[model samples]
Target: MPKGGKHVGKIASKGTSSLSIPGPPSSKPPDVTPSVASVLDELKSVIKQTQEEKEVGEQTLTGINKTHEKVKNEPRVSLYFKQKLQNQYVNALQAAKRELVLLEQCLKKVDEVKVEIGEVQARAAPPSTRNIDDYRSKMHSGLGTMRRGMLMTVLQQYAVEQQVWKGKPGESPPPLCGCVPADEKYRCKPADQVAARVRTEDGEEQWILAEVFSYNSHNHRYCVDDIDEEGHNEQRRYHVSKRRIVPLPRFKADPLTNPEALFRHRQLVLALYPQTTCFYRAIIDSPPKEVAGEYSVLFEDTSYPEGYSPALDVPQRYVLPMRETKKK
Candidate 1:
């Protein structure tokens, strides 16, 4: 299942009206005196531990408390699993989610063209026969096409997101709230639907899922990364468990699986999850040559303009800008 699959930070629960068996209370005077400094020190440590254990669930928090039991004498501060750097992280998560699916499909499935090489022989041939030109030609063949789809998908997805965020044509965010049923939503994907993985001849890359999160000005960005503000601590432990109803990519059985399902699943999860939304920047590159090795998408941020659908042919009478400038 997607790591950190549970909502990181959710609304705190109100107490249930359950009887405590009406046990007799102790007559001893309550020792109200507490070591504020010591408790505060321990609280810091607990917070530190809490921050380290994100993208995790209640069980992990339980274990963390156990490890820090030595310092329990100190006053305890509640730990919550709140979202952090929400806008950038959530957008990054979605972008990562989309490209991940595309990359998996490109790596696992073969192109319909169906060309094969038992092993490429490093054969020396005449320059005219095979050289840089031939190498470029091979890129257009069978497997190349499959890889190209994924690369293009990543690039296009990035372009669309960039445009939306950068105020370019396609850079629009998904709807603000649940205006429509998640299943019926046009661009918004449901959470259980988003899961993606990439596999090469050797093995698969780590499985990942993306969900939305929100941010407020009160939280510290650096500290948020170290904590889940919804409080995954002993005092506020969440009992959320993994549900198998919707199979994420990691949990899927082999054989029936395909690249399409993973992509579809991951996309749905991101859209459906009701988390806060924010914005961030990212860079995406065209996919690498599959023949070289099944490298995953290489994304990084840059100031360059988002890509355009390259014109297939040069426009007639198009002149160089440099030439035009010089003539002027």
Candidate 2:
């Protein structure tokens, strides 16, 4: 069975309940607060120990099966000896299976712990100063509301196509520009829409909308331009590793024809912030109930004391399924 498979539903339900609106901020500091790095170190240790135990258990089961097979095939072996060996194999195999089961549970717990850690970290970290300034500027200039309204209309019209872009459960979403051709020599081409991981001034990486500008074959990196820039002169560019780039989906999935394309309430996602092309981590407060309805999402924003942005309505084109965590 897949890791955490048994706990998937339970976890989702718990997440929904726990993510309530943020309460008023308290003046007192949290007592005995633990550093994120320290906590991560402990989780790392637990994961390592559990992985080792699981491997050993699997090897033991394999060895027992092989030994039993050999004993059964050996005609020269006496019946009494064969029976004794079979009894031992049965006991050993059962014990190994039990151990493997326990290890799987341990892994599931680890994943849950990781999610908790992420929540805490996101809440504690402050929003980017530059982004805040830009947002304030737009609002002051009376451009933010107008831009958001126009964007929402466009997104609503493309809702069906947006749904199809997301990946199925336990899978990575398709690239924004669609999958690269199997025979293609390069993963991306100039002007292709994609998401690139860009590091902010505070040393945190965020996935943002970008367009491929050029490829550096020597270093296997793509030079991409930020798509959110209002003017060509103000646009920023970065040379990112091929692995850090995800192509946008070129096709759409119609929820009318594909029920699976509809997102579930409380599902985690990457949503485009209002009046911006940047995507941020968010949770689906509610999925659209009608074809023309919008998704209600709560974005992770440290600007709020509760570490989450106020619930906002987003069009399907602005929301994508959360990316899968990469294995080490």
Candidate 3:
């Protein structure tokens, strides 16, 4: 061992660093030493093991990413709660009606109480100028009745719209496309366009515009869905059910804006209610690529005013419903 083995102290010397080549230990038994081929085989085995581990690591990362994506793109949970909310609303309506009935009894009681109190107060002290006047009370009393009537009238109008716009005319909006098609009918030209709105399962609402990119025999249908609350503003579903789903609104009696107007002039476009929002790589501030663990996404901006914003941010996913640039 001493004869063949090199000393570490001598190797550490800066002057001897270039000249040193440490040799194997000369042990007493030669049979215990591994052959050069065997040593090479061991190194190869370690290299192969490392490669296999690397492959497994990659596959694991891939699977985890896929699972995350599925969850990210899934439909919202709001739809499920909506029905229960409607049930509660019906219960509230019934309770309100009951309360209104009770209110009649209460009104009689209140009148009696007011009369008695007024008599006592009149006897106890002279009527003050600050006391609520009878006329003002009467006016305030009618407000609740007027509110109920207004609500009923609005509901009736919605019913009428539903009857008239039940999937009328035209096919559903087209699915998000990868590229602008060449066929004039399906191709989205500023000149040829129609906008519409619809209520979603959640009772929230959204507005959408359908402009054909080009005409084709097998043109894919646009996916749109929405909801509304208290008639305040629009709300919509990100993922529209795939089918020929149409909208409640129709082309205006007359164009709000001229044919050349992009989205601005059209009163509806100015009211741009995008029931759906598509996040393309080219457009939006936070595209999927920039957000590493992100993906290209489509979401419905249910709060669209009306036809305010066109479905401007179209999804750039797969080329859904492949069609030719120029139709045959």
Candidate 4:
């Protein structure tokens, strides 16, 4: 009986030895490394410092200018003192100019850094998240809301001017070449992907994916090739008005930094029709809070008596700003 009890005890000891309680996972914080958030914080600090320096430099320049003016206009000032003050003024002016140049360069560097960060974020994002609308939002994210709105208004005005000029006889169309300074802000360049408004055989105008083949400088129009003509023996092409083309955005907008990128409720926009590659005029019923979120829109449809389709949820990539046109 004692031998049996010893065998049982040996089995119990073996079972106890086999049991284990894992020690709590290592509580050490992750190794410190440069991250996107850290870089953004550093950039913000740099911008703030540079802006402050710029204000100070401007103030100093203003003071110097005031003194220089006073010295030049004063008749009582002796020649010796005038000459000395003039030399000092010239030196100070040059120094101030140099400082301003440096500050401008610093601000440009900050912009470059922001662009790099955006590219990194875009590359890290999932493939499904990449799209033209997101790119457009990102490109304009730096602009203030009021500025963006004004830009849109200007574009709409240009569109109107083009339309009016096209109907005139023997008159030169306004230059849509966008060759001047800040040209890109006004016109789409060749080889750029654009959403071009096309009139179908049914006379319905729909926006479709097209590429700018070439610009007709004489007519102020673009020769665009339809992107959906892949299976056709001959490629479909159109000579589209500059006013009818909307360039696709080329970068992803950071939602946190650019809330203005989101469409406003009730704003007119172009949205891809479900189960179709064609884009159509739509009204924003509600905008998504995040860049990745979907937009609720009511697309224009002839079949509906109300002339608008039922509210549909469209992905951010499929929604874009409507081609602006002047109302008659």
Error of 1 at 237 (Å): 15
A best-first ranking of the candidates according to their TM-score comes to 4, 2, 3, 1
Judged by lDDT, which candidate is best? 2
Mind giving the per-residue lDDT tens digits that candidate 2 earns over 61-94? 5666676777777768778667766776776566
Q: By lDDT, rank the candidates, best first.
A: 2, 4, 3, 1
- Stretches of model 2 off by over 4 angstroms after superposition: 1-186, 200-204, 216-220, 231-234, 303-306, 324-328
* Candidate 1 deviant stretches above 4 angstroms: 1-190, 193-280, 288-328
Q: How close is candidate 4 to the true structure, as a TM-score?
A: 0.43
Please write out the lDDT profile of model 3 over residues 1-328, one tens digit for every residue.
0111110001111112322212223342343223333433443443344344434444544554554565566576355455544554555455444433432332233233333333333334322221223222333455543432333333222222221111223433222211222233333332222232334345533333333233333554343322211222332333322232222122111111111111111111112212221111111222222101111222224344541223343212211222112211
- Evaluate residue 141 in candidate 4 and report its C-alpha lDDT on the 0 to 100 scale: 51
- Tell me how many residue pairs clash in candidate 4: 3
**Whole-model lDDT, model 1:** 0.23
Worst 10 residues of 2 by lDDT: 6-15
Q: What is the C-alpha lDDT of each candidate?
A: 0.23, 0.54, 0.28, 0.53
Off by over 4 Å in 4: 1-185, 201-204, 302-307, 315-317, 324-328
Q: What's the CA error at residue 242 for candidate 4, in Å?
A: 1.0
After superposing candidate 3, which stretches have Cα over 4 Å from the reference?
1-176, 179-183, 187-283, 290-328
Window of ten residues with lowest summed lDDT in model 3: 1-10
lDDT score, residue 307, model 3? 15
List model 4 lDDT by residue over 55-98, tens digit each. 55556556666766777777687887677667756765665565
Compared with the true structure, model 3 gives a TM-score of 0.15
